[model samples]
Target chain A: MAKTTTPPDQNGTKTLSDQAYQRLRSDIIHGVLQPDEKLRVEHLRQEYGVGASPLREALSRLTADGFVTAEGQRGFLVAPMSEEDLADITRLRILLEKQALCQSIESGDDAWESQIVAAFYQLEKVEESTDRDPVEWEVRNHDFHEALIAGCTSKWLRRFYSILYDQHKRYRNIALSTEIPRDLHQEHEELRNAALERDQKRAGDAIEHHILRTAEITQRVLREESLQKKERA
Target chain B: MAKTTTPPDQNGTKTLSDQAYQRLRSDIIHGVLQPDEKLRVEHLRQEYGVGASPLREALSRLTADGFVTAEGQRGFLVAPMSEEDLADITRLRILLEKQALCQSIESGDDAWESQIVAAFYQLEKVEESTDRDPVEWEVRNHDFHEALIAGCTSKWLRRFYSILYDQHKRYRNIALSTEIPRDLHQEHEELRNAALERDQKRAGDAIEHHILRTAEITQRVLREESLQKKERA
Candidate 1:
């Protein structure tokens, strides 16, 4: 069993497994481990300074989130990404996002609308600070979209959205390695405006367009990479 | 390492891990092990007549399929279901199914159309049978929907759809203890007719309606279950 080791946090404590889980999850998500790379318990224990038990538990949780795959005694590996998966994930994201926007528009209160506006403002700020670093902007961008759909009453819808968003982030990172068109910011602005005005149909359309555009761009990049690899071979 | 045991067959080969994976997957999916139940490796190894390595490998694969949870030294447990998860899964299924239907409609050839018709006919026959065994109907019903989406080109979309479908099956089984009013056969017919006629809009609408209706029914049942548990307490 993992021990609950919280070092005098005044009010509460955190478990060793929790720490391991967060560390491993971030590593996997941030591409530290690389997709489809084997996750060896012995290596992870040495790297994270955690016991094999806690490390195993963390990997287990990651497996549940679709981020990792356990290959039995062969150990764990980061889940692989492909052009096909990117397209399917994007398509599903669009569908759920549109429905979520509609529901949010129908049920969102003044607070929700204001939050949308605030998130967009922050997003715009992040968009302008391109020279600072892409990482921070990427985080803010995720927050902005999450805020957009925060008013949805369905817990399940939100959870699915989160999963899709995480998957999208991985592909987006890949796209960022290439030349990205500036039109994406403008599209985000349009989506924000539509959401602020509670124009459900317009918001839905904007969201779909935004997602599909990224998918198209990502797919093109992936194809180019494949071609480059083949040329090298 | 799990050894490959050769059972005296023409092929003369079967990996222990592969055998373990198949048996564990079926057991988990078929509800031989209840949700949120702990999976002890030693016990499982003895029970399945497999070694530790093979059992761990099987668990790893099961983890990828969202069937089990790994909790460090606490070992593994079946993934738990919640009402929130159920709703989210259904919403996702609806979204993916709608896209698949759209794609199927646009890209489905004569064979695809015929499959839909054939599946619907078989589905209707199964539904009309007086046995009313939920298990039998459930299996046939899944086959019918899968047939409807068979024309979809995206492998990722189908994979995600299948995952959501399986998750929904778990929840639906729970929901079955409660009374359901709607006739699922009618809904299937509407969806089939729309698809056959290439009425994309109608088909999409019917798909959405069918999914939401099921969600509503399941939600009601889950709510009742919660209430009953509360009263019992």
Candidate 2:
């Protein structure tokens, strides 16, 4: 599990509920808790060294992020993923992401262009290395995409996009462990170049194609995984 | 406030938390709890005649909807709206809605087209009346737009778009009592005609322009309101 390095309580002023919320969010996002897993307040309290009150508070915040579902008095459970949900998530991601890329192309400055270059270089380095862990590569991949969209001016759009992106990432991790197609990298490179040239139409077109292709590939892998599980059953 | 019909209990068994969550969600969406209002769980518990546990669950769900903010142990508060958030929201709505409209036009069967026509007729009836309870108009407006996209096959895009629509509604209501342009109904009528014609490009273009124009008008009103408030302060 990835460890969180929350700043030390230099003033001894950290709230118990805040600590519990941070730990739980990290755990859920990092797949420490299985999807649709029941979350018992008492169990989490004991594990995180917090009390019931603070544990409840932490769980409430996570519920807001769609990481957990509240079953009224039955307690919270990690949200479940289904093939239907996967399709929907990918469709939404494509819609928002393409728009974000267009906005980034229209508004991005030289600094933003340089950041995209930097992110692409870092992503290439990580993709080329076989010795590094898969998890690290996944993190770097997320960072590169984030950097690409950093020039989008809409804060609310960015925030919602981040949530959708994280949800999609969780599903992507479960579906396949293989390297994404080289064509995906090539498409990104084209998209970066188009944006740098301030060709909004081409940038938008490249982003739409890039996103839809990933969805197509991932959906196929997910369908195959489901079929395999059914065969075993 | 729109009353939600509760599911009847077979054995006279009802959970306090379930009741609280439904009521609170309705209130938030219906504009009973104003935006940016501080939400004290203890106060809510007393107001709703529920215990702490159930009230906590209700708050948790609201937080997820971006309607409320959880401050850990300090308690929850309603999410704030500003001109900035409204503008970002409108921009996103234009992008997603246009895509959804285009998809619906390209793929809608006769039944889907009929539904859009019926929804437009109903909307026309509501718009004909001069009784300007913005709240009622708001609800009808949502039904009309949802009907427009009802033919779109992707559930995830619908879900994401609904969230954005709700947030946009909140901001719209905040600025509703202010002055708006008189030709809004004409624009809706034109959009309906475009959709009926099955001209995907024209329909998408009309919807995008309509959405952006509304957003621009509301944003101007909000900015003026802020200036007034500042002057009073």
What DockQ results for candidate 1?
0.29
How far is A218's C-alpha from truth in model 1 (Å)? Answer: 3.8
| Candidate 1 chain A weakest lDDT stretch, 10 residues | A6-15
| Model 1: CAPRI class | acceptable
Locate the minimum summed-lDDT window of 10 residues in model 2 chain B. B6-15
For model 1 the local lDDT of residue B223 reads 84
**lDDT value for model 1:** 0.77
DockQ scores for all the models shown? 0.29, 0.44
Which sections of candidate 2 miss by over 4 Å?
A: A1-32, A40-64, A69-76, A177-185, B1-35, B71-74, B130-133, B178-181
Question: Which residue ranges in model 1 land beyond 4 Å of their true spot?
Answer: A1-21, A35-42, A51-66, A69-77, A178-184, B1-5, B8-89, B178-182, B212-233
Tens-digit per-residue lDDT, B1-233, candidate 1: 66589444422225576687667766766667777888888898889888876677567656656677766446789888777777777777888899898899988899998888887887788788776666667777887898788889876567667777877776776666554646988899999999989898999999999988888888888888789889999
Query: Mind listing the fnat for each candidate?
Result: 0.30, 0.60
lDDT score for residue B79 of model 1? 87
